[model samples]
Target: MEKRNQKRLDKKMLSHYQLQLLDDEDKRSVFLIKLTPLNSLLFFTFFMILITTLIFLGLKYSPLKEYFTSPTVENQAAYKNQLLKLNERILELENNLEANELYIKSIQAVVSGNIKAEKVDSLVVNKFHLNPDSELFKPSEEDSLFRIQIEKEEMEAMKASKNTVPDAKYFTPVKGFVTGKFDLTEKHLAVDISAGEGDVIKSIADGDVLFSNWTPDAGYTLIIRHANDIISMYKHCAKVYKKQGDMVKKGEAIAQVGNTGELTTGPHLHFELWVQGKAVDPEEYIDF
Candidate 1:
């Protein structure tokens, strides 16, 4: 009897426990399952491990990994590097802009005759230096040829102008008193002569009438082209007797003086002389 009782106890200890679902009032089992404690513990542990593994995989392989991991040091460093490069580019652009502004100001000063050509040449040579290996900035053979041709032309022009004499026998355009003189600083390139109304204005030299027209500023205007690149302009005329392309002698009647244009305050003639595309004092070449 003692041996049999020990065998039964051992079997009971090894048997699985009953798990049941029942109605509370009827006390009837609707579903049932049996599991040993060791098996149940093993199943719960495996299920928990599986759930943890799935969560880890989801975070690792998905966009949620950013939230789980620390921020990337490489990305931060790359962004900083890009910002630094942009700053450097900005600085370079600013430097280029400053250099360009200085160059433009120097050019303007040169054009206005405020600075000497020698000074401007020296400034250009000192300010701008071309890199030896830069293809775009280097001067080409064609450029050198063009520069040489320009220098040759300038030399030829200078030689032609060197021994030229001023015209001492230029005809008087009108008998009048000079009221306004040529002043380059004032931008008045012509001399204004006050004359009687309907006073005859004559051509200053033998030339072809280049322009004969009326303007709002100088009502009846005329321009004559003469030899040696000399040009004469007569403005504020009451009447013009010549037309464009008409040939006239040195003392031919070409116009009459009057306050005809909006710029004239009274009967006057505004006379201008141009030599080689530069405005000169008309009094220097013509007797009023």
Candidate 2:
């Protein structure tokens, strides 16, 4: 009896349980699996370890990690970059506004003839404040070439001044009688010459036609730019023979006399001369 009991205990320790699948009606076993107590414990332990490892891998590498991260911290870097760009744009706009204001003030000064000599001197000094002895301020090859050209021009101008004639030669635009004269006080900056209708008018000098257009006050008008900063204007014309930008020779026919514009009472030519932006008496330079 003692021996049999010991045998039974050993068999129980190594015993395997049989798992069987059987047809319900025939009661015949179709599949079977055997698992000992130790084998079952090992299989369960391996499955649990595998499941834990898979869960850890998914959280580490997949998008599920986003849920655990703080969104504000992640977006803060992007926001900082945008803020930096905005600041740069604001600075650029401020600089542009300041430059435009300075330009407008300069134009106003020129138009009102209020630009002071001190202002000009200050501008020059401020623009050229760099030390002349510095290597960075030294002239390049291009600058040397430009300086030579300017010096040559200055020499030519000096020679021309030495040989300058007492009177400048100018062709009479037309043979007519003067009805109105230049008077700065009255704001009549031009001379009105009366002649027969359709009388041919000529250019006083070789120049490029700057303007050729019609206006309610001047009617058909033409302006020419010549050398030495001289400009001539012809107004109240019956017809213009040249277009804007056309090169005209001295004594070339340019227009015809006419009684046009609201200010005219009869057929006449209104001619004006400008030297360096100031209106001058045309009779002083050219005969009617």
Candidate 3:
């Protein structure tokens, strides 16, 4: 029997090695592979790079990417929370818009006369649903007397006020011949006073300017709210010297006469006097 022997590896073997595949019949080399320390290291590096590239491409483009990118419970909950907040915000905006629309509608109703202004006073009275005949609301004898006395005083004051204005107290707004008079049949509620162009128009009484703006039919117009529930309207002016909310005294120059409105035939002032919301004859109040 022959004994087998094993070879020892040293520095020379670690440095370089070779492998060969030979033909069994002639012992001729069919394939040859050479290996070295540096060559082995370069091959291992390239192999690792290829493997890593394959793994990276699979994760980036394949369905297996969902394992890392798909939403978990916490992520889904966060997204749902954001959606709920957005929904709540939208609902809040909708509510605010509805409230604003209702408010605008109420104002339009009042302005268009669909809701009577006097009915608003009734709302205040009806709020508590208390009957006027209730004992708690009944007036005593002294209260009745006091109310009567107050009413008498108010009547006397009104009478005195009427006389005070009739005695040349109201300043004439313009000095001009009347081309148009207050005629209810013609629906001419305002008095048309014809004057030269650029004539300074004055206020008839001490008041605050309620409106000073241009209208298509009335042109440059100014309206003043005076004491004792009196309102004066002056229309078809060339220029307005005062703006809305200005304070003016009697005979103060507020505008210039002009034929600027669509309703005007020539340079004139369309003057209107209203007392307690009713148009009255300006001739009765002013001597113009």
lDDT of 2: 0.75
Better of 2 and 3 by TM-score: 3
The deviation in Å at residue 204 for candidate 2 is: 0.3
TM-score for candidate 3, residues paired by index = 0.45
What would the per-residue lDDT of candidate 3 be over residues 169-206, giving only the tens digit for each residue?
Answer: 68999999999997654656679999999999999999
Model 1's C-alpha root-mean-square deviation from the true structure amounts to 20.3
lDDT of 3 at 239: 96
RMSD of 2: 17.5
Every model: Cα RMSD to truth = 20.3, 17.5, 15.5
> Model 2, range 20-88, lDDT digits (tens) per residue?
999899999999999887688789999999999998888778888667756576588888988999999
Supply candidate 3's per-residue lDDT for 61. 95
Residue pairs with backbone overlap in model 2: none
TM-score of each: 0.44, 0.44, 0.45
Question: Which 10 successive residues of model 3 have the least lDDT summed?
Answer: 118-127
- lDDT winner, 2 or 3: 3
Off by over 4 Å in 2: 1-166
Single out the weakest 10-residue window by summed lDDT for candidate 1. Answer: 117-126
